[model samples]
Target: MVVRIFGISIVVTVISLVVAYLYGGVEALILCAILGIFEVSLSFDNAVINATVLRRMSEFWQKMFLTIGILIAVFGMRLVFPLAVVWITAGLNPVKALDVALNPPADGGEFFPDGSPSYETALTAAHPQIASFGGMFLMMLFLNFIFSQREITWLSWLERPLGRAGKLDQLAVVVASISLIVAAEFLTDEANRSTVLLAGLLGIVTYIAVDGLGSMFEVDEDDIDEAAASSGGGPSQLAVVTGKAGFFLFLYLEVLDASFSFDGVIGAFAITSDPIIIALGLGFIGAMFVRSITIFLVRKGTLDDYVYLEHGAHWAIGALAVILLVSLKWHVNEIITGLIGVVLIAAAFISSLVRNKRLAPEADAEVEKSTPVS
Candidate 1:
């Protein structure tokens, strides 16, 4: 498996290099490598969650995710998303925006010559919007996890009386939409407010629509059990359920990844405006790392060993979501957003290790008791 994985990586690397060479030579290669490292380091949490999900997927879907999913991530989110933002905000034609990104205006010691702003300046300029997007996105993810994990008791209706409404999802959608509209109306300069509002609405609406669609297609646990019993296999009914569960898991993983990439892609304006570079560099490298991490988690059964890693990643994602929302009003640095996630997850991992160590003696004693005295 290691050899196969390495071989696959080599093929991917060679292909990426060839594309980079044709497009921007050494510059593209260097950028891709850097972005790859950045994405991998910041997204370790993503891998853990992805592993948990991937393990549940059918082999067919797993292959699809590895192939089609990678393309969507690389081209759709990383490349097109940023260019779309520029086009929407700056009113630049898509082709021209692509050109400007590829060949930015000369630097005048103030900003890029094509009237494009510097990385820091652009990030500062758009900071509020980025924050709002990230914050709300993460918050929704956090809430979803919390609600899902809670024990649902049919008779315990003490907390909030609206449980029978079946409208929490709708409420979420409406609130997010109104929030964006209101923010656009009052929170920003007239020229830029429309852009920010539209972006926020886009994120919220997109998430809701996608999630809803996924739910519609989801196979229930009972259904999975029936299917498994019908076919008598060593994997068992529970295994089938877990495999089907992977689909939703993969969907959530993709959504989470998309949310994380939003800021990073926007942040790339700080490095270069060329959409090609942003797409080629960040997209290629980031996708590769995501894949590598996914494979690692799947193979090592890391989730079984460290139960809290997913919790930590989700929490980090939640923090990011909140940061994005707050950023709508106040500027938050992407570097800071990335760092906060890394630190939180790293702390969780260390804590998990410590807990495991402390439990070692107890676990060993239990094993000894179960064994015949020798």
Candidate 2:
């Protein structure tokens, strides 16, 4: 499995190096490697969530995720999304935007080059809009998780209260809306406040639409039971084709993947302005690694083994959401964003270990009692 996961990584790296050498020699090759690492480190939590969703899906959809999904992730989000941002925010057509992205104007090493800004400049200028949209979507996703009434919880002290609050219908929407207003009013520049607010609202709408669609198509217990009965007397791990429900879920996952990549895409500019370099280095190499990680977690059932892993991933997402919003006003270190997730997951893992240790004794005693002198 390890080899399978990394086989693509090795191939991607080699291709990246070849592309880099063709484009800009050894320097571009090194940049590609670094960007790949950057994407993987920042997106570990994304893999966890993808696994959580992927495990529910049928084998066909799962295969689609690895095949067609990879193209959408690498090119659509990493390359085209950035171009779209430039085109929409800067009043350039897609073709022109693509051109500018490929050949950014010489900055003379200036952060904000003067007069008719380069592709990076235009894209970076749209950061407020991008951050607001992605941040709000992610914020809603996190709040919905915490507010959900669940049997298992890692941070019960906080989660329990939130879960209760979730009883208020559309509470996640309310919280997200308020958060967006606050961000626009206080955290964003006056010139871009409307843009931020609009983008943020669209983000909320997007999430609501996707989530509502998923709920509408969700397989009911009766349906699952019917499927089970058709097969045999009892429930079985059958690959029940969910059809429409499954397809919507795939859409949801794709949107979710986009939300996670927003910050990474913006942050890539901090490294270089060449869109090709960004796509090849981070999109091709790094995004592939993230995909492999998702496959690994799903195949291995790692989430089941580590009981609190899901909780940790959601917490990390919550942190990332908050960071994305805060980044509107402040320059957050990418490393910090990545580390927060790593630390939370590590802590949750330790907590799971302690929990298992405590439960083990009870299980042993129950087994001994049942043995009855056997």
Candidate 3:
């Protein structure tokens, strides 16, 4: 099972590194390795969150996610995304955009390089809109999770109050709207303010549409009974869905992937502007690990075992959203962004170990009681 899950990622890693070394010698190989490390470190939370969704999907959909979805994640975001940004911002056609991205001009200024704005510059120019969109989309996810009813709480002192406050109608929307407004009003310059606001509103709308539609169309499929039993169910951890409902859920995952990629790709550029190198590192290596990790977690039931892992991942998401919004005005180090998730997740993992230990004796006693005079 482990080999089945991670085989592609391992294959991708070796091939990508070989390609990287060939493309730019040992230096590129080293940089590619570093970027791969960065992406995995920064997006471990992504795996945890993705596992939550993957478990709810059917076997067919899950396979598609790991296969077709991996392709989309690798090439779509890593290759096409930056190219599209450059195409639009640099006034180049698609072909021209690809060409320019592949061959950045040698005119050496900062990002622009004393020449017409390079692909890197165009991408940087588009950051405010990108950040606003991705940040709000992510913020909505975090807010929705944090403000909902859950069986467990990792940080009771904090989550308890937030959950209580969530009782109000549309509180998540209200909070997310206020956050968008705050980012626009204080963070963005007047010239970009309207664009930022529009992007954020679109983010919110996209979330509502995808999530709401998925929920509305979901019906208990034939296999839901098995899913429910396996989950030891109160209403089932897995929602059996097919057709449009399933498609919407799939769409939600992709959009969520895009939101995460906005930063991950940018961080890759910070190391080197070569699109091919970025693809080798961030796409093939890093993204492969992320998806494989999601599969591993689902199969191993790791999230269920480590109860607070989901909570920590969501909190890290919340922090990332804040950082994105803050970065609209000021610089936030990518290392700091990556470390935030790592630290929160680590703390949560340790806390879960402690919690399991505390419950062990009680569980043993209950088992003894149930055993009776056997």
Please, what is the whole-model Cα lDDT of each candidate in the order they appear?
0.65, 0.86, 0.89
- Displacement of the residue 348 alpha carbon in candidate 1, Å: 0.9
| Local accuracy of candidate 2 as per-residue lDDT tens digits, 156-273 | 9998888999999999999999999999988988998999999999999999999888777677678787777888855443343476667878898999999999888888887887
Worst 10 residues of 2 by lDDT: 107-116
* lDDT agreement of model 3 with the native: 0.89
RMSD of 1: 6.0
Q: Write down the lDDT that model 1 would get.
A: 0.65
User: For candidate 3, what's the RMSD?
Assistant: 4.1
What ranges in model 1 sit over 4 Å off?
A: 14-28, 107-134, 147-202, 212-222, 228-252, 329-331, 372-374
The candidate maximizing lDDT is 3
- Give candidate 2's whole-model lDDT: 0.86
lDDT (10s digit) by residue, model 3, range 1-374: 99998998899899989999999999999999998999999899999999988887778788888888988998999998899899988888999788778777765444444355777878999999999999999999999998887779999998989998999989999999999999999999999999999999999999988889888867666556766777787453564346556677788899998898889888777899999999889999999999999999999999989999999999999999999999999988899999999999999999999999999999999999899694
Residue 306 displacement (Å), model 3: 0.6
